[model samples]
Target: MSEELGMVIGRGFDTWKRNIGIAFPFVLDMLFSGIFFLLVAGVVALVIGIDVFLSFTEGAGAVFGSMEAGENPQIVEIFGLVELIRPYIGLLLVAFFIVVVGWIIIR
Candidate 1:
């Protein structure tokens, strides 16, 4: 019975080792991706905050320049968004679609 228990313990250890090996890369990838995403979100939040505040100073309507849509007020002459980003609305739409799809898949 002792020998049988030892074999069971050994098999458990082997199984654990194999699982850890398979999960290691995924764990590392998740860690790096999470850190990167946090940084990106922080930067985006800060930029949008500044842009909205600046827009308020330029006399834009509070409702129109609100953070709900991530509006930027600094480019009043060019409209709300940064001019360079205007042409990439389709890319933004695609990204939004992908995020929604991913959320639905995960959920």
Candidate 2:
């Protein structure tokens, strides 16, 4: 079983090596998608106001503060920003899925 697994892994690597051309575009797409997400997040953060965003950071800081004070730190504050973006999460996921599927189909 181990030898068969090794052969399968080797064949997979060989296939990937041979398909570098097809793989490169997917790599670029992933890179661009990550950059785009950061840009959008930054823009949204600005539009929502720094104070509002900082509140989330501050909440996270408070959790750390509690730990420093030798108390139990609440970790839920770390997800504050995620909560703020909850409404947009579905749209982002759907768009990302579409892009990935389209890339696969095109390749």
lDDT (tens digit, per residue) of candidate 1 on 1-107? 35688899999988878899788899899999999999999998799778656655553444455634676534453554454355457767987999999999999
Per-prediction TM-score, please? Answer: 0.41, 0.36
lDDT of each: 0.71, 0.75
Q: Output the lDDT of residue 98, model 1.
A: 92
lDDT per residue for candidate 2 within 20-79, as digits (tens), equals 999999989999999999999899768757755666676667666656877644554445
Winning candidate number (lDDT): 2
Off by over 4 Å in 2: 1-10, 53-107
Supply candidate 2's per-residue lDDT for 58.
Answer: 67
Give me candidate 2's TM-score against the actual structure.
Answer: 0.36
Off by over 4 Å in 1: 1-18, 60-107
